[model samples]
Target: MLSILEKFDIFGVPIKLKTIKKQEQFKSSQSGVIAIIIMILSLAYFFYVISLWINGKLIPKVTTSQRMIDYTTYEWENSEISFTLYDIRSKINPFTKENNIIMPVLLEISGLIISAYPRLLFSTLQVDGDKNVITIDKGKLVLSQVDGSKEDDQEDIKQYFVFFTKCRQDWMEEGGYCADQQTIDDYFSTNHGLLFLSINLQQYNYETLEFDEIKKTQFFAFEEKSPFYSQVVLQKQQTTIDDGILFSNFKTFEVIKDYEVNTQAVSAKFAQDTVITVDNIQLEFESLGAFIFRIDNIQANETILMPKLGEVLAQIGSIVNIIMLLKILSNMINTAMLESTILHQIIEIYYPQFQHVQITKNFLGQIKQVHYKGVEIKLANFQHKYNQLLEIARTKFTFNNLIQEISRVQLVLINQIGIQNIKNIFKIEEDLKFFESDRLSNSNHQIQNLVSVLPEESPKKSEFERFELFNSEFPS
Candidate 1:
């Protein structure tokens, strides 16, 4: 079984050759250097794989893609939005010389007044439109859309007109009088107050099963004289997250706000078009402080977390295979070096005259030929001779044959000399010589009788038979 295994020339399996002399098992410095280099490269490759795993490159990855959507037909049940107005009142005292006492600005959304001093006054408001309404429920604001709204047409969509005004009929009636000229001067002073509008949007979180709020705030400084109008476009965003652990996808809704203020100044006559009138009484306020919020478009983004364990393993295996190519090259170098050494030894042993022969090899270190004293021997011829020598050594120097030859030589000495004479010659004690001369004499007499019964002309004689015949003829 071992011999069968040795016959197999498997790569990377080292099988020691018993036929080759131990000293002739050749090694070269080039092979040793190549082996060291291969070891270093293998270590480097292992570390490289470890680094990729440690850096999260071998884990799941997130990818995102976005596309535009029509807001009219999209659902808004998973989202909530609200707006907050801040810093509308002046901090300076009205009685000071500067007299920078700006009155609190009121927020008019869908004809419902929201006071700045007390924050939001009305929790819900319904406008006289197709399906226009704003309501705050469960700490979140909801905007209702018209049923069966057209996708391409947005004329009937609910547009929230938020107006920041002062000195309205309700304000005057509450105070029981109008502001004096000094108070009016403070309202329009050089240090105009800044209004900050914060739009809070909440989206459902699938992982945590909760609502996550995102706030976008923008500040606008009220103009001292002319009024400007701003247009706010609220866009809807639908995001889908692929959870690897759960092996499922979750969707959430988000509202994004984009606004632009018209820098062109509007005259009082032109601003009167946007003024809110109650019982034919025009409200007194600046024209520049109004925002029209409308939901017009939607955006969809999908995030995918790709699990890549198999791919990472495949990548690592490919890299290892590439590194193993160097190991194959190292094995080839060692094999060539060993073969060249064996060839030189064979030539020196078989032909002593070629001891000083010049051996030639190719670029790959293969033994090509041996040249000595105008005679040349090719590699094939040298290998043939080496095989013949191996066959002869295997047949002649076997263990069993060597043992048999030693046994035969011992028998001949015992028969020729008596056991007692042999013991004295070898300095053996009397108890050590177990066999007696009578037993030996009886064995010789039986051998003589057996030889006499044999044919005179035998095709072949055994070594013992020939030895016994020679002894009988010479009367030894």
Candidate 2:
């Protein structure tokens, strides 16, 4: 019997129990075609999804808005103070080899018998120029003047007092007054009587347009507040002297002040500083424990890639391809284990069995041709039994066992019902023929005696031989 699945063909492929074997070889069948289509489409979509992810294009349209958030902060600081070390000099050609100067400023603190003094040293000038020297010596910060007694040597030497400050904001807020030398002098006198230097400036005179002879030398001094002072002040000035002019105060100074720094709504930036520069002077203040730096007011710009429904379906399709592959494997296994090859083998092994059943059917057909009423009823009953047995065997064991079981049932019918019924119908037809024949009375008597001697239960040998002879002689 055919299974429900086996009853139909889809896409030119037979859906039989044993068809799985065909799939194992990748036959050109409906299931194989469908699987191939699924696999191809699924893989295509899978790759498409991957490409979208790579290009960052998988985000859905609905999720484009970002939620705004508020954050409060306190105490903004900078790692290195942003203060100008020098006013941009118009005459200083920094790129020219003749005027370009590289200065090394060292901040050093001496140890115990080392005087506990902080020193600033100018190294290259003492070694190469030999024109002047600046250092912290004997607990005093000093600057020695350059000797340019001759007019020719005067123009090469330049002098300036360097000032540095701790805070950039204070310098900007003070309206430049904090840089005034007189203000620094007054401020210094109140704090301590610091030593001050008075010297003449000659190199590259801004007004004279030429360096002239320096006619005087002077000593200057400043007191150390503390090496670890959280706030320190610096002053830089140029000294000028002439035949008609008297020595006077220098230019500018810087001072540190103590005030409460405000902290409030500070936005944070999620970015890096792209430009970096070095500081001319760096301070380490033992008075301040920590110097905190902050970069704020930056907006957060986080992005996420979200897949669309189509992309999700594509992913599911890829997964379904895997299931299809598994199903193919399952089909191959079932074909190997359960699908019947026995039917084919039975047909080959039981050829004679089917031949015997065919012979019995032929005999029943002959009995029908005779059209004897009584024998037709018996033949019909036997034929019904024959058909039933054939149905049972074929339905139960499938096509493979059909021939073998039919042969067995035919043998039983031939012995019990089929042969006797066919012989009886043949004998009745011969008797009717004998009556209708234009034969002698003796021939008729002989035929009647031959029929009587054929016993109802078991016929004699002579009588059976005579019946065969009469059957052969009977008209068609």
Candidate 3:
């Protein structure tokens, strides 16, 4: 077992267990403190690393990069835009003393007029004068027709406008509200009517096979002094996150609104290929008294969230390497000190004259020479004696010789008694009757002098006599 164990060397060189014990005891008072310090530091750093790893600090770092792309590249044809208007203006009814609010009655887009009705899908409408909401589904936009005939001229940019009006008296009467012209004028002028516009822009997500809506709310106020116009620019943004092995993609549309008030009537032509005039304040029955907006241009922003596994590994590996280096350095120092101490002890054991000798060491803490009785002895001489002692210590008594002797005795016993008789002898019980009779006889005798039974002169028997006596007992 010892021979097999000696063959296993972890550090390229096998060290004796005795040498390690000597190092532990040599200058133990000082070395113990240093060992304790090293142990504390190593354990602290080890636990610190374990805690960081447990807390996910060892995971890959996240990185993000953003860029812009053309609107044509984006899938805008499948996207939809929704508009929701809320009337927050207070209009007290003369009869019931309740508030009356007006909502959009018609939606005009590209010379086509469509009835304005609540087309909300997710939420209910609140019309208690607090949150009177009117939802309109605008559907999808035709970008190619709005951009123009020539693809190259699309860079010049054109806007598409949609108008919502609430001026019709019949539409107001249907809602059980006042249909008089004076009531309509007073609602617009005295109340300074405010409309909460919620624009929901939706983008199609190819990954989820669904549409994600991004909603923006703006407040538009109608005053007798000036007209308020809110211009909104729709921009598309896509984001991707690297989730370990796969990436998660999300698409969302962003609405950017620019509000301006024109004191005079402004003429803004917003159509596919024709122009239309816009008035500052619409008292006329044919004018759009509600909100007006146009889609200006489209811009795309792409952001990517990436994980840096290599950098994380490098940082963790660097810390582990520093700790391992410290451990290896400490082991090397201990090994060197152990070797020097072992050599000195071996030299003292071989030569009693060197017991009081002073050993000199170099800066590296290696034994350079030994000084004794005004004479200097080189470490090479001591090393030679140490090697001789090691050889003597390695010489062990072989168990093979003992095993051979046992085998010979077993063969002799087998030949004298036959294998079957040997087995029977082992199985037989001992006879205690002779032992009992002998004990009784000895008790009855009670010899006074114990020296009388001592032999005066005895003749030694030779090997032949002993063999004859053995043969007589066995008798083949």
Which candidate leads in lDDT?
A: 1
Q: Name the lDDT value of residue 337 in candidate 1.
A: 68
**Candidate 3 residue lDDT tens string, 1-476:** 98788678555654535434554234433355556766676677667655664454443333333444333322233223334333344534221112233334333334232223322121134434433344444343322353336465443222334434333334443334534667757765664455455555554333343446666556554443443334445544344434342334433434222223222333222211222233222223232333434343344443333234444455556776675566555666666665556555654554454566676767566568766555555567555654565454333123675577689877866765457655655544333436876656554333422222235332333422332211233222
Off by over 4 Å in 2: 1-33, 49-290, 293-476
Question: What number of clashing residue pairs does each candidate have, in the order they appear?
Answer: 2, 10, 0
Between candidates 2 and 3, the one scoring higher on TM-score is: 3
Give, for candidate 1, the lowest lDDT window spanning 10 residues. 129-138
lDDT of 2 by residue, 1-476 (tens): 46766668465754555343553242434445556776776777677766765454454322112233222122212111211112122222111112222121223221111122222232222313322233222122221223324343322221111232222222222222122444334433432222222122223233332344342322222233421111121122222222121232223211111111222221111011111113323332211011112112222222222344455666667676675675675456444333223332333243322222222223112324221222222445444544454454346576556676788877765654456554554555343455645354346645644454234444344553322211333222
List per-prediction Cα lDDT, in the order shown: 0.48, 0.32, 0.43
RMSD list, candidates in order: 15.7, 29.6, 18.4
Comparing 1 and 3 by lDDT, which wins? Answer: 1
Q: What are the models' TM-scores?
A: 0.45, 0.20, 0.42
Whole-structure CA lDDT of model 1: 0.48
TM-score of predicted structure 1: 0.45
